[model samples]
Target chain A: MSEQAGYVPVVGAVAEPQPAPEKSYRFSEQAIQELEEILTHYPDKKSAILPALWIAQREYDGYLPPQAIQEVADRLERPFVEVEGVATFYTMYNLRKRGRHHLEVCTCLTCAVMGAYEVVHHLEKRLGVKVGQTTSDGEFTLSEVECLNYCGAATVVQVGDKYFGNITKENVDELIETLRNSNEFTPADLANAIVRLHIPERTAKK
Target chain B: MAETLVLLKHRDVPGIENIDIYEQHGGYAGLKKALAMERDAVINEIKTSGLRGRGGAGFPAWIKWSGIPKDTKKPHYVLCNADEGEPGTFKDRELMLKLPHMVIEGMIIAAYATQSAKGYIYIRGEFVESARSIRRAIDQAYKKGYLGKSICGKEGFDFDLYIHMGAGSYECGEESALMSSLMGERGQPRLKFPHAPLPIHEGVWQSPTLINNVETYAAASQILAHGGAWYATMGTENSKGTKIISVSGHVKKPGNYEVELGYPVLDMIELAGGVTGGKLKAVIPGGSSVPIIPAELCKDFKLDYDAHQVVQYSMRTMRLPVVGSGGFMVFNDKTDIVVLMRRTAEFYTHESCGKCTPCREGTRWIFKILSRITTGGGLPGDIDLLVNICDQIDGRSYCGLGDAAAWPIMGAIKHFRHEFEYWIEHKRSPVGEDCLPPAPEPLNPLLTLTPV
Candidate 1:
């Protein structure tokens, strides 16, 4: 069953009653192009709003500002509330300021067995921030999640889609150091070379 | 493209999830094929193919579809269960987002098989992108003569599909609750089994209806085109066709693993880099509602639906029977099994809907006591109290969710008494320290991407 493009006019895909604000996320043409490429996957551009929001959140320090939300809304031709609803629905998506770096500690089974409680407690003590709270220096936001699905590596964290697998308190300091000196690194360097990224989403290994 | 199963077969074919690419890949062939067949042949093929519901129950698809008698002569309706409220489950969302047309096409095929024209996609509210995609895809089908009016060039056959966003209730994942929500009612679990009164024979708007999971509908398209035997060959005996297992929790590589039905859970673990240092303690093979069996025990556990049932039903001496929600929640050695039970108990307590008192207030009492005990605020008799509370909630609610909610606490206490005692006595989870890695280095500022 082949679907023809531009068949039914989407309520927001083409135009909306009110316009959105101009984008000012310090996003480069290259990043915007990358996002544009992703949006092309759908017949209606509005379908890309979630991934667009994810990209925007990453660019804006884990939270999407009203303008950031509007930018994605406008890009997808969807109502601003529609985009906002999505940004707020997922616990993972941040719409407010977190830390300079986001550390999501998975406390599910494998890592829990490996003393993930210690990792969580240590991070809480070390960073002096409770889960969901950012460090005073704004360098880190420590959060506990149900599972990151990498129990094999237990004690995992995603500092922006990059998986740091099989973590421990000993490696916590090094991970923090890496974040502090992130200026010298590229994500290609830190994403647990073990688990590949969500590129093309769900491209699982055989 | 009208409809294409992109995520299911996207890698094998380009433009599979993409509208333009899907169109180029000869995507809507199934719909065209479906329209050409007499709806009876379509139904019979699904019947013979041995397609099972992708939803946890794994019921026979054709039998469920055929429940509605054609001779009754009532209006036929079709529903797509895209509510996808299962935790640790994002496969439906991913598939819908990637290939909206595929689901649309699948819905069309299922509608034809069940002899229903009007359909609704009841999607979870959290799936914003999926909703948008399905909505857009339906609009695309309508524009292309794929969704509305007549099918391809067929007569006396027309289909209409609508996407209704959910109100953020996990309980709505149940088909009956989903029906209630679609009818615009608050999603409170019904204690009584609303007898499967042949929905296809008589359903929504009081017509015969066929309701299928998004994946099942997609598979219907495949079976309609490739034939029953071809479709049956891909899966295991008793349970034919592949299954999309959402491997979450503690796996190194967490995501959807689409495999032939009989693949072992161990294979899925290795697929996830051998469970992050191989310290997997226990796993909730289905979902949190499913009992947490030791990971070591699950090594030989077959991922097939029937095999899992056998192992969990007969082998595992559970107090309550398992419900079929394919939510694989992994627990590592570091997890405070007892505390985890407390959290789950609390969720069931808070979400019980209270239609039945035994479940309504009973769940809450257990959760409160379990929480206090886990946090080191328990009285001496709390463990027995917790067990008693579980007993009260089990089989005492209006819906299976009550028993489903109580299973884990009762089972965990039965299996891991020491962990619970440790938490009660020490006021801490035996899970020790959380071993999660520290935050990674921020994106290089010079690299032009700022940290969020």
Candidate 2:
């Protein structure tokens, strides 16, 4: 059954303060265009929910607030509950405020055996916060995540969207310092790393 | 004892990622072969190859394609399950990253076999590089007339292919959940047995959808070009062709290695340059879901569908031999069994979709107990309680995730009960005596785009 996407404004029963209707969330023109193009790939507009949430999260500063979720649901012509259900099911979507940089350490079996726990302990001790807490300055949030699927490079860590594999206590400290000073790690750096690691000298064929 | 590189063949060739280079290296030869044949003949060719689903289930691929009703009025959809989130399994990601078109070529041929007009490559969201690579390949395929209207310039063979990015859900690797996610719903798995319709009969907006993992599609592409009979000549009985094992964890060289089925587990370890420390202590032959095998028991083990043999124990009835998704993880003696189990429990706990009761509640309960035990709060009967809880989750949960969550706990308890006992008795982890060296920093973690 197709769900209707019509909006219903909530008039708070015990309101301290409420935003005006004009303050409703909307994606930037570029994002909306990106979403529109994404919609063309799917037979049903609903299939674009995951990517739509990605666009919304990137636009709304690394987390899907209620407004962002509702805006996505409204724009995609899907029900809010459906959008929320999809959002909550995935681990990547931050429901609440995360830090400027979120460090997700892969603590699954491969990474764990490769000393992922030590990295977690090191980060927690270094950052003065537990696994899921952000620093007081709102700069970092440390989380132990399930497999990031880069098993060849065990003990992988993701800062924003960039992935650093074979992470150790030393590298973790370096990565934290780099993220602290820089707002973004350029894609060029990541691309160069992938090419270098993946392209080794020709070897004997199996 | 040599590695067999069927799927990874020519994968390391410079510029092989490009369609033109890919074609020059005999890439689209499979699709050309498939398109030239009668559709059923193509399916029969795959059937003859004896290729099983490389996604972990080991189900025969051709039979799965042929299961869809031949005369259904609704359009069939082929889904390429590139959601490679299973812990320790990065074969699909590497396959796609190195050979995106090979995977695409597999999907194109699979689409032809199933008579599907539209296909979706559902890649995991974290693979930013792979998603871009596959997108480029799809565009190139369209330009070269291998996809879209009148595929390969055959007048009536029209097919449309699109890439759908998954927003990080391990459960989406389950076929039913994958279809549900593709339909824009939460990626929780729908009930499969007893009542719910199979994806082949009623999937994705109630249309017959054929979904196969990326490795399966890549294998299928090869099978088409080489012919089923030729492909069948590789492996042992039942488990045909070469399997790519994503070997990681406590090994000297951890990476994806392709070997013919029935290759000895000991040889695989040797191929990986052996254990990191002393000798191997244990092995999680499949992904983290299957039970771990003690190194002693691994002596006669082979890398095949039914290679693992459960040792005799009173609780052995629950254990089954599994080659789940080919995520082979080796562990050395220095590894802490309790901590490993704790991490395993935490993973299922964090990933449990909360759809059904047992998995939701059971996983959390186990995780909490594990957390307590690892932190020195373990009680006397905590082992029994953990085992009992795992039994409950394993027996009645909605999907395979429940069984997966149950397996490692049972395996650890069965094999390494002393480790748990030491933790409970001494109020400390047994691993305190054997400190592992810090992991080596990745040589190159990021990859820049190579111009096509």
Candidate 3:
């Protein structure tokens, strides 16, 4: 069942071979400053791994390639395999490349009963791709997610940082069109929002 | 009874998320009251209120609050479990989004009572909007001196709160696993008491820590603000205070409703504009982890910790529903019990952290068997096999996730055995053509080519 429906890689999948560490670090100076400030929030640099990976996801543009994982390990002074283990254990951290917009429809129990599958089938038809595949233009990637926890708005479709709720097969096309023209809710933006949350406003303002 | 507005009282107020508006609406009054009292006095207030943990366990709040060592040599930490990943729950999401200050104020009060120097709100990563609201509130609190060193001019009372974002792991909602995730490890459960010391003694960084659900902390703030005795006036003898029920699924008015504990289950259904589409069928009174109650049994139940216990005693069965985390999900007559249980099984399978053998391997097997049955490959023994699998996984697992995965399936089979038998004998859903969760497509294309 997971072979077809599961879009995110199963957690704790064996780590792929790491790219050579010779590539220069890609994190900009501001990103470095943000990481340094985040370090102060926790006692050890190791606790900063989750936030560092979020920054890596942002810096690497959407998904964490091997180079991005290496950059995070190098920055935190941890083992590459150790960082990869943490990254792979989480479903939100995309291991492979994704389209500019990742459409995650909640197909958990409440959403399922409320016609979440119809929404999924509609998106597949509109995008001309199956559940886990990206559109031809690399604009949209469709996948069924576990409960986004907004079940009151069943059939909640998460587009990056934003959650479009009360969606159905009928209104999903309007949402897709809106997402097609907007770039604010990309995977990078999702990572950026999570990263900024860790840094206190007092520190961020300065 | 009607919806009682306590935590959500000022939820719809304009600019309530801001410090100024929140302060004007009697915000931080609880912190002021708590700061004036002795540390033990603050705990005494909570004890008076009889408030239990709203994070599903229903453990008494005062026991955990007073559990922290008074003369601890190590630094104490207060952690808020804001990762609301329960399938049918979104109350914490709304609380954090609308009443961020209330949650923060409660955390501050907890830090004061526990004498903790540091705290963290480990929110799930999908809740970026909620996290943003909390971020703004925390910044405002720091600016107003509600947080940081010498809070509100109290000497030797310094508290620092930080936001730790989880990367989409439901297992982190478990307390020990939450600490594991906070320290940047795999979000897996640790051995519990009798096997290991409780988290209050040796927790994150080997320090005494106090962890409470988002609703628990928010209720703490309210309990402190109004004296515990005043707060105790509502609810049943054992259960006190109002609980925010996240009503969804086949309900006409699906949203978060903060109703007092001991409210009738049937009344709650009506409160949410009654069930939509058809007659009421079943209700998962708690989150998906608890047992699913057939509509006939739901009438006598009340929304409280002890009421659920009464249900178990009357039925003479251990597998009964509870008011768990207040994720009230109502289903209509058109819903198919077998199909709903299949989706429920799939959720637990996807979320099992693989920390223990019983949960990791068992959840997969359960899903596999259910999928097979749903796809028209059910053996006559499949029903008993599913029960056997549930029994093995129930008490044997490391944490509650295994039990959570087993209970609903067990509950479904207990109440709707006929549905399972019909499916096995007829090779079709008993609900017929319009059944929800529509039948699963066969995993193999060739199987679809052949007729049932």
Candidate 4:
């Protein structure tokens, strides 16, 4: 039964060894200025780590590479291990390479009970890859993440920066095509293209 | 159906996101009113209002503010926990996205009450739209003199607020973990007692800090404007005022609803357009971390904090308290209990912060056992194995997150033992057979599989 369902426990699995970096990296001028502006908010420079990581990740394609992590630590005047530790602790900071389109499907309770697993299955079937696996063409990486705080729209799927709630298999297909064919595609652009996809509901109002 | 619009009064208003529009609707009136009154009088009013923290702990808000000593030589700070990462919860996200000023106004008033010159709103990284909206609001606030020195034209009354983003750690929702993360360390909770002072006495950067939920601060602003007694008139004896509930899962309409305390949970579901399939199987009254109450037990369920005190059928063995953060999730008849329990354990295991051994090991062990049980590899005594693991992780763990990680296993086994038993006997999940896609939809060459 264990093998039949493709469910394998991550425990006892040997972790892949990370290769040492080949080159050192530094924050760009703009990112350095942004970091300085961010530092003014906190009493100490260390508090800027989270935002610094965000900037570094953006500078070096969506994921935080080892070089980028080291650069962030150097800029913030922190030890290498300390910055890496902070980076690995948070889920949003992807250490390994991710596809150009990272699709985070919320499979937590609210989304789960509302058939988010079915959406996961749909993506696996459509993309011919399982969760945590990127498509062979280096276009999409599918992961079943925890809640992204849009519980009202069950089965919420986040692509790039924008979120699409009330996702169905049909909508998922359209999402794949939209990302697959777009020339200039960020979540903000995708949000405008799929504005009508999410049905806004009545919330607490006067 | 008591539509009290204290916190969410301007939620649906289109232009309320604008500072000027918000001010037109009596938005910052609370902060102004609180600022005009004496500091002690402001504190006394909140104390009289009986407001509690909405961030799962439910600690009294006024007591936390009053704990800050006036004579402290160090600067005081106020922090708002806007990292709405708890499973099945998104109330704070909605509040921040729709009405950013109200939450910020609440923070200013709270900073004033606690005598803090600085504040921070630690928002989660996934909330891109929320963070952008709030950044715009913060900029607007500074320009309007709501944030910088000489606030509201009162000389020597200076306050500064900043919004910091957490990369993405659920444990950062814990107050101490939040502080550690803010200091660029691993987002793990510190050993509070037997070591250091309470955060209110000594917190971030060794200064007395006051940390409250976004909703709590939003409620504080309203309490100041309308007067404590007016806010106190709603809800039960102790749990006064309205609560913004984020209702989701197997409902005809799933969304956030602002309902007064002591209202029936069933009524809130109805307001959410009733159950999806016309049958309600269970309701996690708080967030997913709370015990799952079966449908029958929810007949008398109310929306207040005390309402959560009425122990359901699952509370026979493990009597856990329910000071939930208003993440009301409803499960329908088609839902598989065992699968939900497995997923819940997996979330905790993934988010265990690896600080203490009990949670780090126990959460993963519970998930492994559940995974085996669901996959037909369960031993006959797997039920006892789960209960025993939960017993160790419940109280012996370092933080509430560990205890929270343990309760669902106890509750699911206590109430839905038959579901686990069925999986073990049949060697597969009862619902897993129907839930999986039929024949994988015949993948084409364009979507070739390369199993990792």
Candidate 5:
């Protein structure tokens, strides 16, 4: 994740000319309605960019592809570059596709002293992939994240919307096994949960 | 001193997240009390409570509440900073998870006092479960006439609350950066006061805005329910009331403990079941941002905002530690100060918003030097170089993130200079071969294996 530092969008770089792909829209009817409802929560349509990107992430299968950025830009009446910049600034909006479950291990100060690296190594060995790589079977994507702020349960691992705490090198296998048998789309579920939080129950019922 | 239970009084009760359970336990009484009185009286209650901001920096809460304009020329807004990104701090997570109504009730009271018709709680994206609890509480509050038009049968008083979730960015925790994020821009900060108007004057689409931490709002509700003078009876002279300290690392029973402000530091450690695994080496009294204090010096301080005064006597005191956001982390004998500082540097480096040069370049340089020292590539003048870089970034950045990045490194070098000198002299940790945080391994073996 440190590799994402000092990020500056490339401007005016020359490249071989290629035909632009035909633009397509992928947001479902419910997603459009949810985005409209979220817009009402804010004073303007541009304030809905973050939640709109979440709707896009769920519609595009857990990551923000180029078309997803374009769709969000078109919906919010903002420029593509403006939407792209906002999307990349945040860490949770994935630009690339992830596996079935995104396993983010906390490796900050308290977690490091509590042996978070050993848990990372154990997961790396079991998953047969390094940090930031998805397994060949697309079952899991492992990454070392910053603190989840649940340091009381140091060495916490966040799988989608849930945080699994008190994790150690020995007990991580059980979490992986549990994730293996589940059929939920963890990343999309995370995005959906965040989107639902923005809509009030009364508004949703309407 | 024993743990005080004010905000966490009914934390252990089952179904307290539900509105009925919360009201049964004397919740919403604060809102009812606030609604009956004049708006200025509500603000006066908070002023008398002697409560300071719990999100850190200990600013008086009443000043911000009273700063909102009385005449409603534009729509006034109230915000709750639920983006808890401090490393060892999870008190807000538990407060929202268990006592959502406390936070909502406080926000409602703030809205009434500030004459704000609409409010938004900007929660972090990672805390979906906590946000769901708040969402349920808000829905229930509406059903009971605690929200929406003419809240709680108070004629012509209308307030609406909404939750706005943030994408991942630690810079957004800063108040101005939070406002920028709330306005749907990049999560970078704007220029602060003196050069620019304060947020109270112009914020959130150029309207008067009042923003407080989750704990601060929760504490506000308590101060209004039980009179301010009654709540001000606890703690030291300068700091009053109880603070929830999130105790983590090397402690036996690591969790959130609410204690009076002036409680002794050592007593707080014992309250969390003492240091585990080995004798105590040091304690990061607050979150990762504050200065680290050696175990010997820990006895002199108390858990209050003024605890930083002790650091004035230290030899190389460029920074001081406060009861900041209450992230009390304890370290045992096996921990390595140099490695710990390296991880701390890496965090600030990754989270720097890159809006300022001193922070953007300096944090990366600090991390690079520390990474080289830890990976067996130390130079003779590297310690001085680290100090120079920290000095450059200390007060030079746009936000406190830069200052936060510099404090712990300087503090570790001030107290444990020998550990850094040992690493420079002999390219290994002075603690042992088996330090708590071992040296870094190449993240991807394939990249290292490939021919250059």
Candidate 6:
């Protein structure tokens, strides 16, 4: 699942119409610099795809939408359809639009064996929207993914940049509320607030 | 009564454990029926069965078999991925030990359907006893005309099966890596290039090979015996037939339990002696690669397909319904979510193969940050820094293995941020205040501290 970080193309078998390419959307200078720096860490050019998409998604509101994947494909020199296949294969690559905040629920074997199905159901029922479908308010989008790699502790999740392992429906609701109420929150603030409950240093910036 | 392979399917056949007993119970009837049918009919039968892989990825078994290019210039080969490396899962071992013949029979039918003259069972090294049993069963099958040429007394259909044991690495669970390992390589993933692309078309000496999980092969026997419709009616609409769940951890009876695909997790837990420890903390629904769900969130979860779609929660890994090897690992209040993560991180790092920079270095970086945080040596910005690194590692790696390493760390920090903070601020675990097990709650893998 999520624990093993090996390099691979988002390999998938998808037959989709290839849209014509357009001019690259100008990423904020900070976003470009940030993504470029991340790419420098990788030895290969294509290795920066997931990170590039992440930056691209965050910079252009939320979600890669098809064009973004294509743009990144062109930039990386990856084939258009092949890049699309990679974009769609993994859950982290968001094809559709999402809320301002994104939440990831782990449904890997450890979590599933530990009861992740109910976690997903509870979140969907609480959000009044099925996973992969954004909320009516666009505050959130529910997506069920495979393992975030916590076999020993099932029912783990990630909201924004913070990971909330050993979570329950009650905690999930609180997390959703915290995100719904707060905008421009740092990863530390949310992590400390919804996860550890009290951590000044980690949340010092906020 | 002794536990045996028959328990996997829960058949009432007498003497199912012994070879003679199994033969007497009409075990090889499917192979007999297979020999009597045309190759395409057998392939079409599997296609009609709606059988997905029993392994974690629910890929269609027949379509995979169909992709072998029967008329290719090269001979098509069959490979069984018996490498059960998923954490909190061990259903394949029991099946291999108990019903090796079932796998053999299924392989025979598949060989006939795909016209594969040679077959190999790639089992894990940890399964010593199971491998022995499987080897014995293969020998027995050979003597009885099921494995060798003129199998079941039919002419011109020669097929041979061999069991290849792995050196025990989780990455090898991946098909391309598994093929590489079977061919005596380092067991790392390969890239799919244009023109010379696709692992299936060229695996193990570059042959058009068909690879299936062990359990999927076993399903072939049932499809041959009872037909696809019978198999289809057993599970959910999209998910057909029963699955054997290797239930372990936090349950009284931690063993493999055969179940219909649509059963509830609660029912499955109850079958395994419900809640050995009080206040269920979390549950790993699939294998270690899938995310964990806390007990409260899992109140209504049913252990079936479509119910626990991982993509909803940002989980991208596939959870095969234990087709290759069924296994389920459960966690309770005593389990430390953080310490578990730290341990899991160590596994991925140790097995990283160091192929890609993001993954090779990322797994190490994640572990290092986690180690620093868990051992009270964490800097204030370490958590964010760790998340930031995992963020890059998530989709940047060559395969899903990189995501596997990054997602757990990401999920752990999200749910158990206090543990990391405490390790940094107080150099202690959060369980000190909570009413834990008799003494202290076991260390969470993410938050576990290295001894000073």
- Docking level of model 5: acceptable
Off by over 4 Å in 3: A1-22, B309-321, B437-452
| Model 5 misplacement above 4 A | A1-21, B309-319, B437-452
Candidate 6, position A143, lDDT: 57
Query: Per-residue alpha-carbon lDDT of model 5 for B1-452, expressed as tens digits?
Result: 78889999999999999998898999999999999999999999999998999998899998998999989999999999999999899999999999999999999999999999999999999999999999999999999999999998899889999999999888999999999999888899888888788889898888999989999999999998999998899888889999999999999999999999988889989999999989999999889999888999888989898888322222344536569999999999989899999888988888899999999999989988998888789999998888888888887877889989988888888889899999989999888977864533645432111011
| Candidate 3 per-residue lDDT over residues B1-452, each given as its tens digit | 67899899999999999999999999999999999999999999999999999999899999999999998599999999999998899999999999999999999999999989999999999999999999999999999999989999999899999999999889999999999999988899898898988999999988899999999999999999999998899898989989999999999999999999998889999999999998999999888988888899888899998865321222235635489988899999988888888888888888899888988888888888777777678889988888888777877867899989988888788788898888888888888867764533433332211010
Q: Per lDDT, what order, best first?
A: 5, 3, 2, 4, 6, 1
Which sequence of candidate numbers ranks them by DockQ, best first? 5, 3, 2, 4, 1, 6
Q: What share of the true interface contacts does candidate 1 keep?
A: 0.02
Per-prediction interface RMSD? 10.8, 10.6, 5.7, 8.1, 4.4, 18.1
Reference-based lDDT, each prediction: 0.64, 0.80, 0.88, 0.79, 0.89, 0.64
Residue B328 accuracy (lDDT) in model 3: 91
- Across A31-149, the per-residue lDDT of candidate 6 in tens digits comes to 55555554443335664554455555555455566677777776677776765654553334456665767666755435544556567778777888765666888777665543333
- Per-candidate DockQ versus the true complex? 0.04, 0.31, 0.41, 0.30, 0.47, 0.03
The CAPRI classification for model 3 reads as acceptable
* Model with the higher lDDT, candidate 4 or 5: 5
Better of 2 and 4 by lDDT: 2
**Weakest 10 consecutive residues, lDDT, candidate 5 chain B?**
B443-452
Per-residue accuracy of model 4 over A1-206 as CA lDDT, tens digit each = 24658766688687876785655675666556666766777888888787788777767766677898888888889887888988888877778777878788887888776677788888998998877788999888887788888988988998877788998766889888988897543422322221111111111011
Stretches > 4 Å off in candidate 2 = A1-23, A185-206, B311-316, B435-452
- Show the lowest summed lDDT stretch of 10 residues, model 3 chain B: B443-452
Q: What is candidate 3's local distance difference test score?
A: 0.88
Q: How far is candidate 3 from the true structure (C-alpha RMSD, Å)?
A: 6.1
lDDT of 2 by residue, B209-305 (tens): 8989999999988998888898899998889899999899888899999999888888888899899876788898888887888899887788888
lDDT of model 1, residue B414? 65
| Candidate 3 interface CA RMSD, Å | 5.7
lDDT tens digits by residue: candidate 6, B1-452? 11223226534454455578777766887888888999888888888888888777787787777777767587767888888767666566666767777888898898888777878787764445566667778777777777778877778788977655554356777887777666544567777445355655787668777887877888888788778777777778877777777776677777677777767766777787877766667666666555556676666666665654332123344332222234566677766666566656765765665668899898878777766665557788887788778767776766778877766566566656776787788865565523211111113343221100
RMSD of each: 13.0, 7.7, 6.1, 8.1, 4.9, 21.4
Better by TM-score, candidate 6 or 3 = 3
From the highest TM-score down, the ranking of the candidates is 5, 3, 4, 2, 1, 6
lDDT score at residue B79, model 6, on the 0-100 scale: 83
